[model samples]
Target: MDWTGWIERWGEPGVLAVAGLLVGLGFGFFAQRSRFCLRGAVIEFWHGRFADKLAVWLLAFSSAVVLVQALVVAGGLDVSTARQLSARGSLSGALVGGLIFGVGMVLTRGCASRLLVLSAQGNLRALLSGLVFAVVAQAALGGVLAPLREAISGWWVVEGGPSRSLLALFGVGPWDGLAFGALWLVVAVFFAHHSGWGFWKWAGGIGTGVMVALAWFATYQVMSHSFEPVQIQGLTFSGPSAEWLMRVLSEPGKPWTFGLGLMPGVFLGSMLGAALGREFKVETFGPGYSLPRYVTGAVLMGFGSMLAGGCAVGAGMTGGAIFAVTAWLTLGGMWLGGGLADRLIDGRHA
Candidate 1:
């Protein structure tokens, strides 16, 4: 409750970075342990199977929604100033970008966060893809691809505030959101049971979701306590990837921030998780894998994430937990795109 000591010890940026690190660590550890991945869920759904992957994804998503909504309803958290709600957004960008990202994930066989986790677990393929993803994301953010991203994003704009808040647009109260989350939680639990998930699987999924809520809460707390302004945010990979990339390449002395800490935290946490699970092993691309395919997917994901304003965990679970309009639209587009991609690409191969 008392942030004074922390502020005095580490200052605003340090404290914020530490918060991000803690949240990222939790997310990475749990996600790695649970094998939480939207791509797997998407693949399962497209294949017409309700299985453990879907159950894990649902558990993570619903847990985030339930906790976040409960905090808001209880006056324990105020998300009004969060960038997902207060910043201007683009519906066209969300739709198009999400679709591209979904396709890219299928091609790469992993989403942005999943790639990071896999990389830490010593997957050379994922390491290469993640590096490409970061480069592309950086290019999209302010480099060569910025112009194209801006052009697409400018197609349909929505002002900040209520316009971006799905809860406001739908005339739903926080209590209603809480109830909806609870319903989904029940569904997730049912599926988990049906799939015969062990304790670690289910618990890890829930922990991954809890980290999202904690990210929001932690950032909010930092913003509320600091004299310097801070952006309230949750678990997101796109912006952080870009930020980390820039920090490494150009800004050695860049001020410490939440995103700066989050990237490394995830890597360290995932490494720890892999080590603990005895899953850490150096893996390179096999003869069956194509370097060109991963390169192409990484390029698409990089550009798409920038245009969409987030990646899967970013816009999907994090933004969806708070009922952001663009986030939901982005999520819908991802499902549509993932299904189509799976059917067209993987299906043919199968």
Candidate 2:
């Protein structure tokens, strides 16, 4: 069907909202069932077991690469069309930002998306993290840290003149991208299959990755197509989390964007999932010291996400899926930061 004909039949906003709801439901369900979390994944890895979480994350990244490639072929979607994709080659910022975000995630015990889902489950620590994430993200975007980001971005040079992603760094074509994605999938599957974890968790990890890929498809094809002018498609978290807060206050004449609509849907869907599974519980800081720790962790996470340009899910999982160079840097930074935090915190606890 022609683009215009499809729009006329469904109406942009209505179709977009439905797409948001579907993406939300999928995200919520997967997160709740598999407990898929980047922070947890890295921690599990560091502990030398429960590597299944890391497998799940890799599975998601592989799936996204495949799915996005398929969408580009099928829907005539162009990766170069999106600003997020084009805004590549920020290596220095990504490394620094990722380290901060990663450390913050370890301290906070969750990434941005995890914080959102956990908050819905009445986790007070997650709630604090989400609040802090929003504020710090805003600060980095336009407030205190904006200048630093701009300077870093300006100083970095792209060897090949900004292309779609890091794939360009290696001069990879679509076929090469596919091959690299398959390599990751093979590694993830091997880990899951050989790990001592039961089939249920292994399958759940794979399922989580598939769900994330589905989210990419839904956003790019279903939601973006529903718009009149058609917005650029991408999956990243640093800016969206902050945008959601502003959207809440400026809802009167606000134009509905996929990111804005999908976030709340994920939150509500998570709440519903928790309730249905009888897993809903109100968890909070236990005592005097815990509250301060939680708050401090949340604040750090917020600022860190902003500096890195997204949270674990935003830059790590989603952007990684599409092979974005900055996302990879963010992932590395997160790992470095999270690793240090874990050692420090564990040492202190010991």
Candidate 3:
């Protein structure tokens, strides 16, 4: 298919909006059905239970890599368009930011993306959490915390040479990237089978990964072909949350971008899924848990995600799939941060 030509011919604002909705619906359905969540998956892995969730996550990551590679080879998409996929800084920020994000999620009981999905399912606490996260993220991106983030990011420089994809770093040609990606996929599948997760769960996990890749393809195609072409981006949660807020406040004057539209579409699609499944449940801050905890978690997540430059969906699954070094850093940081929180909570309980 001549994707470029097709998009040029018919990729109007309305068509792009429809494409965004489709992407959102696909993601919501897959996430809801598979219960795919990075923080939750990491926590389960830490506890040595629900190992299946981790497998699912890895499978999704691997799937995205494969799909992205195919798109690149076919000349339909370029991985570099997505900010997270760029060969950027080293492990410091991603690791630290991810750790903070992970710990915050534990304290709050869900990651940023999970909070969005849960909120759609009627979790008022998550709604509150999402709001706090949006505010803090905006603040960090351009508010009080902006200076700190900029200073830290500026300090770190990619050593040895300019940023390059993992495949390039290893001295492999274009095809090598695909081969390496497939290796990860094979490993994920093998681990899943050995971990005692049923075949159905494993399949669900793989399906979730494919869905993520599809989201990238959908967005890339829609945006590239739109009347106003934008840099290619993919499934991320943090920045978009804040952007959505800004757009809502600054309506037609702001002129809705694909990123802005996609964020809300995901939320709406998830809500529809919950309503259809009869799984929506309204929840709020329970007794004894002060508002401070909720606020703190949100703030930490917002700042952490901003510094890290993406959330779990952005860095861990989406960026990781594309072999971005920053994504790995974020994943490491998120896990460490979560582990730290777990330790602190455990000590307090003890």
Candidate 4:
């Protein structure tokens, strides 16, 4: 089904990037409209409310798993090449790095994805933080911090051993994708009806879940069929943000690909969504000097997401969809970290 051969009669390299942009736009739009923040979702539970945000996230995750499984059953996609399930994934890194990212998001008041949406609404704080995040993430990934990160990660990244996926652990193959997906589907259905949920929230969860699957499909099939195939991947923010910056500064004319295109799409789509929602406003730093706080937090998040291999949307939602143990470990670390930070913030205000 070499799509590139069929489509290349009139095809372009930017096709993958363009697909990423369109999908990313929808992801950003829904994220903003639904106020989807995993930190807020988790902190809410600690505040004694029913963690509606968490439930919504589960819906997205479970739904993603189900869809991915469908692709496996149909022999339409492969998750092995995805970073979340790859050998480079480290249990130790996922725990430590995810904890750092979680706490950082709590302080910054958003994750990388949220930062983009918040910036669209004129939050200068988010804008600054996002910039710091991109720079630091790039550094951690392949710049000054790369050596240290490699050192820390090499110690624990499983080498030639059973992979971290449950299916892999049990010596299973693609059918496990479907089994795992169905498992999450049930979890999503169980939390379908929560009090105080609006129509848009439900829609956002389902829509985001579908979008994640679309990401998998688009990259796996479309890119595979292209003149140049890309490593199959789903939605992720941290590393791509850095890649976007590098592309802008050094390779503005470079052809678009799935990840690079997705970054700007999320940013642009968030702005459109904010404007439509009438939530667009020129905002500045909150009470008393919080600029430094966000910068510091952004630094932590930059390194953290890179170390953990993904952020909330990447690891928490997308990776968790396939029941990746690494995603769960990192997600658990994020919740614990976010809870701790929320309590500290509460203590200060109390």
Candidate 5:
């Protein structure tokens, strides 16, 4: 896998960006086709239904875990240097930010990635909210909100490496993690079968997970071959969203990276998916959706994602696949927060 030729042709950042674009294209296409949304899954779960939404999400998640662990076991990938595992983490931020993000998604009717998908499909509401989410995410990353986020993140910290790796904390190895993933994959299969989903639904869900694994693998490969330092990363929305936002407004000359390519790749891929499916249609706010509600939700999600260090797909699926401890904690917080929000808010309306 000599990357010298590719790097010489496209530069380090260009090569990484291309890898990100390819991965993001697959993820966006599959996610759009499968109608994958964590918000939908959480809502369905809290409402006591193991239906298509839950099945799709389960399939995506379990598939990512299985594939990622398998890569580790086969020595095809090493995540030791990935930020999710290598950086100091904040338990408090993961929990609190997860909770806030969960509530925000429920209110906004979609998570960050989902919003991007819908926006690509011509959903005006999602377009606006996604823009707002990116703005607030940028603010949280280094704007006025940075101080507050830093304060919260400082409360309970965990050292990187073993302390942040769930497998290490539990005295388990990649084999064990692979087995766990396999078990859940079986569960996902059961639910998918029970839900009577069509081929595209199930296939698309699995494809989305595969993209997550590929992102990890691809980035690692780029890092291994590059002459310059490259951080191995997986699919994530928070940091990328902030990075892309800043790239547009402040740092247009910033070197191309995986995240830079990912944002637009998802958008274009989603557009292609929608066009092929004939699902592309302009939609906007109407009865039951208010401007204020969406704005508030976007703000919460932006802040929460930054505080928690990732969004639903970022922390929940991508990091979860690698068995990152803080990521798991954040995921737990999201589920709990989503459930509470649905019960308290949507329940009252019902």
Candidate 6:
């Protein structure tokens, strides 16, 4: 649709970048306040800990699902061009990529988003890992590793299959977002029943979910109303991190992008959170040889997230409610990999 001209007309680099920064800042603030990491939340629940964190996670995702669906229905947003919308990435890629990303998150002790927040909080170790992750992700997107990524994705494309949510199989509805959201909310409420998280923590979690949906709505507004259409993407960290890094190297003269705004916002917001909590401290790897683990994990995450098409934040929670094939497949793979990491890590200490 001659998006280039549209970008020129409406996507004033400054405005778009600022919009992205605001969205990112909202996400970072809420996430930090809530301590929201899907990996940690799910794993904590798995360990027989109370499901407060799990409830928080589910509530956020389900809430986002409800709002995102409603926004699309209201015609306030259109996501036809989003990465999550394609629904045709290679299943094989999802499997391998999801698993690898999960394992990497375990090694690094956090996901891509978590690493960025940590980096901002003065974790030099996290900064290094985050850089490696962004650089490697860049390779998969269009650098030396692009050919390999393309080849793998081409090999296992989920061609000719319905890309809609599992609910479609029931034939009762198609993208019945309200019903879908209701079901998730019900589940979340049920879990929340026993959770001990105070009202404020729960609010933070719910706020995070709303922000996720708001990201979609905000980006959609920009894409639909402007004479020029920007890519209709929502919040995600993996590729955006790389995009920002690559731009710094190649397009140093250009201002930050809308998508790129989230990375720095998350970092800065997290730093602010830490400072407020008196938890801000420069952290580094201690003796006992931690560098290899972090490096390997970062590399795996970089490639795996690219291969799987999204991380937990991008695919598991955001794409998850949509019933996208990649969402389910990636989460499934992440579960397997995360479980494996749990066992390996436990055994190492044992």
Please write out the lDDT profile of model 2 over residues 44-130, one tens digit for every residue.
777666566776666666766776666665654455645447654566767777887777777777888788888888887788768
Alpha carbon deviation, residue 48, candidate 1 (Å)? 1.3
Assess candidate 2 and give its lDDT.
0.69
lDDT values of the candidates? 0.91, 0.69, 0.72, 0.78, 0.93, 0.75
- Candidate 1, position 205, lDDT: 95
Q: How well is each residue in 142-161 modelled by candidate 1, as lDDT tens digits?
A: 99999999999999999999
Best by lDDT: 5
Q: Cα deviation of 108 in candidate 1 (Å)?
A: 0.7
- For candidate 5, write residues 155-244 as lDDT tens digits: 999999999998998999999999999999999999999989588779999999999999999898888888788889999998898888
Q: lDDT per residue, candidate 6, 196-247, as tens digits?
A: 6477457767887887887777666666656644666667887788888878
Ranking by lDDT: 5, 1, 4, 6, 3, 2
Pairs in steric clash, model 1: none
Off by over 4 Å in 5: 348-350
Which residue runs of candidate 1 sit more than 4 Å off their true CA positions? 348-350
Prediction 6 TM-score vs. true:
0.88
Worst lDDT run of 10 residues, candidate 1, spans 341-350
How do the predictions measure up, each by TM-score? 0.98, 0.87, 0.87, 0.90, 0.98, 0.88
TM-score of 1: 0.98
Judging by TM-score, tell me the better candidate of 3 and 5: 5
lDDT, candidate 2, residue 92?
70
Which run of 10 residues does model 5 get worst, by summed lDDT? Answer: 245-254
